[model samples]
Target: MAAPAELQAALDLLRGLRERHGIDVVTTAQAARSAPAQAAALALRHLLPADLIWHIEGHEVLARLASGDVLVLGLDPSPRVNGRAVREGRLRRATIDEGSARAVFELAAALWSNPKFLPEIEPIGTLMPPPSDALAVPRGMEFVSAMARSDRPLPKVVDEVPTPGWLAPGLLGLAGPRRQAFERTVWNALRFLLLHELGHVCLGHLELGARKQRYRMIEELRIRDGAAPPKAGGLTDEARRALEIEADGFAAARLFGEAHERDASTGLQAGMLSATASALLGAALVPIIFHAMQVFSETPEPLSTHPPLWFRADAMMRAAMPGAGTGALLDAPLRHWAANDALQRPLAAAGHTHPLLGQWLGPVIDGGLDGPARRVLAEARFARDGLLRGRLRVQQQVVPSRGP
Candidate 1:
């Protein structure tokens, strides 16, 4: 079926570009029947390639372009986005090939696919020492802070703590099947991300916004459709933010087929713990890590054109497992943990008085110095202690009218 008006716009651009540059969205079934041309276009929908143009014998599709009407572009390896589309009068050409977008997504996939290395510090989720006992932290928060930095900036955990060497070959590291598991995670993520760009282009986000390119981190940046600002080609950051949530819905639906919106219990409830499960959880945790990196690197808010970390992460998980609810809160397990006064006593006896420290204590099957994936499961708080939660809170206070 022809796409919606938004997606149909891409075809219009394709026709226009063909009129100007004699290029089309080639496919094996389409005009570009040559193996090389077909491969390049197929690659756009699947894997990322080093270069857009691949030399193929017995192919006249590209050879015919030797007349300088078309450019066979390659992927842009850098994941950091620095472009925005602007509308203009007349049939002017873009300074950069929109096809290069595959490169940026490929780069993001490579980063997210990387294994969790040893010697990483996990992010702090609502955990800290009281002002009265800041100097005398009985829990290892002080130690973690000291090890992470001599002059820690209040929050000890940045995005994640160092992956335990012990768990490297076992639970966390990309060893054996874990590597494959993580790769799958990256693949699913790429589908969501790349399709999102398609969503933007087809949705006509580029033509609606200012013709100037704007850079944003891959974590939050997304191609989206939104209400155009009042001024012609005037892109409002708020409008862009709203667009992200909409695009996320579009991406999630296509990535994960329609499932129940809310499942009261998922496999996690059945004590399903495996490298694959961890890999999936790790995939869910990726945006959170990148968001923390953005904070650490001090990326400005102007680049933030998407929903907050909590919203995005929650959306992904909820889509993946209906009713997962942000992946921050463990509904059933959390309830049991909260009610167990005995659990709190043991945590207190162990000098883990901070309520956040509850994340560290659990039974053998549940947790034992929870690994990154397990810790994610154990974490039952957002809005107050989450890295994004803190940011979201401040944002809500500042812009009291923002949507959840």
Candidate 2:
């Protein structure tokens, strides 16, 4: 595939995805709600060839059109928000669901609250503490009663900045470097994801034999009712896996860019390396842990448009760093997520559904929601890091890392 013709085709696809995706783009307020994802797109945008004629949709998923245009789906902020404030000397409450409200408020905090939308951080009122009663309500109450007036008024939809444009930093529950780490992870993972799609476009697979079979296969998948069997149009699982692997390779290569140069006399290299590691694993977490997809099997993937998440993550590391081994890149991320207890947070938040969801999700951070990815990343670290030539190490037993 690296032969010149294939190479040029791939180059064209990459250029087409990046350049043609960003032409004459005008960003609207709603489109900017996905600041992290958009920032990732823009970062990729900055790296592309200047002559390319792509214009990014301020909102959309990654897709290439037959017309040579592209789309990157972004976050759309909720048109509505909750909380209360006294307006013209009256207390007003919003009718809202608590969970959804919390998630949106958290997102708003993670995003627009950061001061570094210029480049780096998340915030909410923690930058300044408002009384707990201001945000709190009687348990399970749909409408919140207003608290005594203070310098900072209660959060309301009207208070949200219109057209936050991703650059507007927001806050979460975090403080200090912990906050920075979360923001960096948010930005980096989304960037790596965009890179993977760019990889597909770059490899020219979208226009090539066998790989181009994705179009027909997509139509097959779209056949929701039991009309006809889903078809691969002669695209085997192996071939599809190869295409996905190639795309992941594209993402990994750029995701780890120029870390050594930053190593200089200063200590910036370490931070850069950590950020890159976050990107690689963060990309994997999306489909595996977050989206609740079926876990990858020990076998080659079945017919699908892409490889499984674990496979993609492992393939990506192996392709990019080769002999350096993938374990180095995975250990810290795996450990960090576990130590922070992040993976379980959602299941916990699910209330009554937590038990069934946990079983479905693979409760052991060592293996389940989708176990194979976590296991593979862990094993790669153990074997390559030389902790064990035999058996796998679970989250409970830490393999002293040579660390990702």
Candidate 3:
């Protein structure tokens, strides 16, 4: 099914569940105190659309929602808030380069076009980031804490901006004359995120009252009967699983639009330059292994959350051949998560109660969360002369040019 159509189906299911279960939902950036609410918020938020009213509340949250307003509970800032300010060296940089700007525009456009990505209903505003000097910039930072409200709302709720942490740094770091590679992948990630959030809001999965009330009622009934009561909906294992898969589908379709198959042939071309550059750098590291020990080696698990180190290498292999779809291109990094030792260990620790949860948590748990395409750009080297043809050749390994 079309991504938009599928998104609508998911929303319909959520709305139906809310009506049956009886709850008033809202979407917000607030942090919920209770573990259940936190999990619900996390899962529900992914299902909501970009535009929708989110009522953030803390004290008396469920009661407020039942009375009418949806209570959005914003989490307090991290306690480690070292109020101490540190000076950062000023570096004047372009707010956007041609390639990066184009990429952002495309991402926004895709989200706007896809119902699943943007959702049918949502709150007004765009998802952008706070300014910072962090190396990864907007991509990794929890930069999307605020939203921009729009006066006109109907078909679309949130006015999304693809200015998150990933786009800027990815664009800045790429080596090619044209930033075609970074643009495509960065836009894909942005679209995926926007649509996932929009799903929750549109679906009414974030509603209040009914969820808490049902939980209380279930417990009360169980006490009276001296037997377990049937489970109510909302935040159930099935619900969370459905929502995650829905978002993944939304992201996948958005990345590989309707005509993605037709355009699949170009995958190799997009990564040719990027692959070559990385291979050469890797080869260069081999020679200076001892001297460049620090540079050559990566810090072990917990420090790195990006997909496996070899992910890009695999992408390089796939991109060297023709007929790889956006899905295949994207899978290179996901495979890293699948292969992560940290994630496997956790599944064993948790007894794998939920397979879907394990899959979702793998990336974050194993520190395999890095975006492969974006990372390539983040590591791209800019030639001083900026030569059109003087770029280094990166194959499986970087080999020096044979001819003079």
Candidate 4:
């Protein structure tokens, strides 16, 4: 491990940059607060890169720091923050080894210098201290005053203690075969979130708002869309939202590159896998009558944010083994027979077929269908039902939405 003095020097340098760059950071320390919160803070600090500094307060650390620039250290939580202290046992015992710590610190440092690391969203100037600060801290208000010193005047990070009753879901519960699937989902989701945030910073949407009214409108829209609100001293919701979408697109393009359109194709392939697996599993499991119910229950509902599951399963099956002629038209009986077997078998009877589903749903057995296959299936069904097909040509009445 690097010497404490050396670490301190690195921290000093980062903080200096934050000050010079106009970035704001918040601090939290375990030695400054109750035992529980302190431990959690300590664990959090270690897990983070050394480029990030640990701010020592009384018993806890809850301040934010710039993820890429600025390290916030030293503060007394009792002065302004509210909440009971955390317990030591509840905190995970994992420590950042010297090597990993150095690696992370270096990563952060490199990111700081990289043009890619620049903020994608505009910073919203705001700050809030811990609840304890109001109770006994005369200088607790420094949280806001400190913002004045920043050159960028952006809230880079916010540090606050976790609530007393807070319980982070255990990773163990997500273990086993299901765990891998869950991790895939979580990984993609987290990556998406980070990308979106980066997009905001990179796109320069922060400067779009000029007043509280405009900012508030942006914030409301973001909330309605199910995004996490900006931290106490972070960027505005509008900036974050716009940036998040940008990041998602960036990540999608970067990860898939020239295969950007191929991702859709890939997703379709996964859907085929899901469909094949579902059909096989369904057939293996129970009575033929039960097959219809299982298929119906597992069927993807229309108008969902996600694509149809059956369609995805079918697409994946096609991708896995390509070059087959139109099986639907060639062997109608065979398709039904095959679907019967698929419907009987449980997805668990199969292995990691989630990836065959594509993107978020690719990791789990329970998810939406493939888009292409869903359309094809719908068309096939439509063709089979001539009456319904003819009805499609009739005019339909438009239903207006009720005012909210």
- Evaluated with TM-score, which candidate comes out highest? 2
Whole-model lDDT, candidate 4?
0.27
lDDT of 3 by residue, 1-404 (tens): 22455444434543454466443343343323222223334433333233442322231011112323222212112211000100011100001112121223333222222222212122112323222323221222121112111122211111233335444443343334233322333333333333333333333333311333422111101111222223222223222323333333333333334223434444424322233222222211111111111121222221121222233323322332233333523223333323423113322222122232234233333444446534432232121011113232111223221222
| Reference-based lDDT, each prediction | 0.32, 0.34, 0.27, 0.27
TM-score, cand. 4 vs. native: 0.25
Off by over 4 Å in 3: 1-178, 198-234, 257-259, 265-267, 270-404
Worst 10 residues of 2 by lDDT: 84-93
Q: How many residue pairs clash in each candidate?
A: 16, 36, 41, 100
The alpha-carbon lDDT assigned to residue 219 of candidate 3 equals 12
Instruction: Give residue 378's lDDT in candidate 4 (0 to 100).
Output: 46
Off by over 4 Å in 2: 1-27, 34-41, 47-170, 210-234, 259-273, 289-291, 294-305, 316-404
Residue-level lDDT of model 4, residues 151-261, one tens digit each, is 342332223312212112222222333333322222322222222233333333232232222121111111111223332123322222223333333433322232223
Instruction: Output the worst ten-in-a-row residue range by lDDT, candidate 4.
Output: 81-90
* lDDT of candidate 2 at residue 164, scale 0 to 100: 29
List CA RMSD, all candidates.
Answer: 15.5, 16.5, 23.1, 21.7
All candidates: TM-score: 0.38, 0.42, 0.25, 0.25
Q: Name the best candidate (by lDDT).
A: 2
